[model samples]
Target chain A: MNPISSYLSSSIGRKWIVALTGLGLFGFVVGHMIGNLQVFIGPEPLNRYGHFLQGLGELLWVVRLGLLAMLVAHVVFTIKLRLENRAARGTPYAVTTRRAATLPARMMALSGLMVLCFIVFHLLHFTAQKIDPSFLALHDDKGRHDVYRMMILGFQSKAASGFYVVAVGLLAMHLNHGIGSLFQTLGLNSAKVRPLWEKGGVAFSWLIFLGYASIPVAVLTGVLK
Target chain B: MNLHLKVWRQKDAKSAGKLADIEARNIPEDASFLEMLDIVNDDLTGKGEEPIAFDHDCREGICGTCSLSINGVPHGPSETTTCQLYMRKFKDGETIHVEPFRAKTFPVVRDLIVDRSAFDRIQQAGGFITARTGSAQDANCLPVPKVAADAAMEAAACIGCGACVAACPNASAMLFVGAKVSHLALLPQGQAERTSRALKMVRTMDEEGFGNCSNYLECEAVCPADIPASVIARLNREYTVAAVKDGVA
Candidate 1:
């Protein structure tokens, strides 16, 4: 606990954790995005892919457990760093009314929390096969539960699709800062490279949001059934 | 060029401060910002009024002595120190609002003179390399990559100016503490005492009543040395590592 405490308190230690956990989560997002793109491949292929993933059974659980650990570690480290920063500042500095904090810096924490909440709800709605009975009843011609069909059915409700859209939008905002910050924390940012990194982060975030959100929107609009 | 100045005037720490407007009629537009102040002081002297007393030395922007919140910016609109700011940057007949560095730890002594001794105390707590001086060892004795050495030198360039504190909305000395920690922690010469040094310096920085860094980045922007905010990140990493090592022991 003391070692963990010191790690929590140290500057570089926090960054190392952030970088490692961030990279892990980034990899997960890439894989998740690719798997999700199956939705656009049409229902048959996507449902088959989902069943195949479900067939992995114990191996899939191992992968999921590993991802859960990584996510938990990332969240814990982030909250610890934030709290430490607050404690270090004994009093607030004064500023004139004309000079306000920039929008991105001010909203980073809020956006991050929103993304966290969204992830939980997302897992409940789509992954855990709970909360929605219609998703549980979804089956393919082969008599296997079709996760892809359930995803489409879930998004058919305007309220659910709207919520997913908003969540994905906020996730983009979180990634906008988080991605650039990950490079900076790892000591990879420089004057020459920062602008490129910033642009890359923006591009990556938009791509993820657009790709992830499109499925739900398409299903809700009847572009997919 | 003539300019109107509104400067904060306070008799003592306990007294409520006020903005005292004074006319600074000058003939030279090319004068440096402080030089313009000198002219104003001379005018006040001629009128049998007390001259505005502000902290300044070296005028070369090397020393971190000159501190003032010009208009709303820490060193005026320039990305440099107040001493490096020239009157040529300002327009004639413009009204400049000058005030002392406003932070709880930095109380005004008189006029623009703030007691920045808190920074000094934090530095004294651990900001030095404890390595004993010896015969000049071959620079090759320690193989430091070029990148690490460059980062260390950049951190070492901090002049202990309280500008970072003044510019920060939280008055956090994360930049200063980060700079001090990184300067030593990154170098082979400073590695032996890295853990202890970080612990002592950070404790002192916190004890001095400086605010935490919320990543506002104003400290980096206002810093005359242009020290990067990455140093703070490095400091955070070092501190965490040290704490972990200490815990294991």
Candidate 2:
């Protein structure tokens, strides 16, 4: 085997790949969550932010492609790792207990898959305007693409709002375990600050969850309209 | 005290195993978990029935030979080995389930015994220091910092028990491999082969069909030696550095 293959095939190599890609996606979420909060500052700022992003043209596509690549690498490696992990335990335990494993930790794959579904549905709903015809038609008085109205209207429905809330909750749970684990997987954790990293993961995950969820929640509750 | 056990019974590795229920009457409270099995085996033998087979040695929690998944937890509910588990931990007439360490790489030798030579093979790959025969160096010649020495000693505490493997959802041996790697990598004497040691041991561990760590931390909780999971992080650091260096080479 070549040196690269040998290295990547090892467990540590796979973890490094997972951690790096996960950190990238993590950074994207933090930025995206904060950016989405622009809805509260009124439609002018939020729509202008959208217009500014659209003005970037080709640069926007490049960033999107990069994020897409990171997402693919993260998901593919996770699946590969999970398959190998499943194969390691050929026999299932008759009576198993979740003694040390937390709910989010154990539900990583499930929540991850849920988040994936949400992402797809989300893009279709907002970006492509395929899921909802109204999402494509709405515009502000300034003759600009009213992203702020699109978001508020998109989440005004009970079903869409509920789905967004549930998906974001799952995302939060995934981040809770994934963020803290990134340190360990990357070998950044030490005895001195292990607790800080672990606890910090929970706090950060919840922060992202509440931040993202608040937008749809505000629209549904008529706070953002 | 009277106890009931639902012990796993398998004819061989290729065959299926089932839980064989057995009754232990008048068991003393102080009897260790292994002793209770022994008494049960004796009764089975006297009755002209096949005795239950389980692995045990040193019975003192040091050999890492004894393995049992008692009541759904590896090494029972205690943070100690199965041999160290006593009847007093269970209430009278409590029903317990005993099963061998089940991992794809660790096939059951019999009922409760599993072939754990994979660990020996991993250790053999690079878990030691190799030096030429010469005059012994002075103890103070290579001074290791107290923190480094303590960290190395902590990693060295693993008893090679398969509990970490058994407890892991993916049955990953990262903790075991991590402990083995960190123990040597921390010491000044182990510096000569540090890079190669990390690379070789990790390859061997992967080849042994062990799973990847998913950060569940179950190994730390169920470990008989209470080996922390941070050693895994150190092992990750060591392996990455080695792999990157080797790739460059």
Candidate with top lDDT is 2
lDDT score at residue B237, model 1, on the 0-100 scale? 65
Per-model interface RMSD values are 4.4, 1.0
Error of 1 at B185 (Å): 4.4
Clashing pairs in 2: none
> What is candidate 1's lDDT per residue for A56-102, written digit by digit as tens?
99999999998889888888877776665565433333335224355
Q: Candidate 2, DockQ to 2 decimals?
A: 0.81
TM-score of each: 0.79, 0.98
lDDT of 2 by residue, A1-225 (tens): 888888777888988888999999999999988878999999999888888888999999999999999999889988999999999997877777667789999999999999999999999998898988776777788877999989988888899999999999999999999999999999999878899999999999999989999999999888999
Under CAPRI classification, how is model 2 graded? high
Give the per-residue lDDT digits (tens) of candidate 1, residues B1-249: 888999988787778778899999964877777888899999999999999988899889898888888987877777778888888888889988888887777888888888989888877888887765877778888999998889889999898878788777667788898899899888888888888888778777766766655566778888889898878767766776666566666
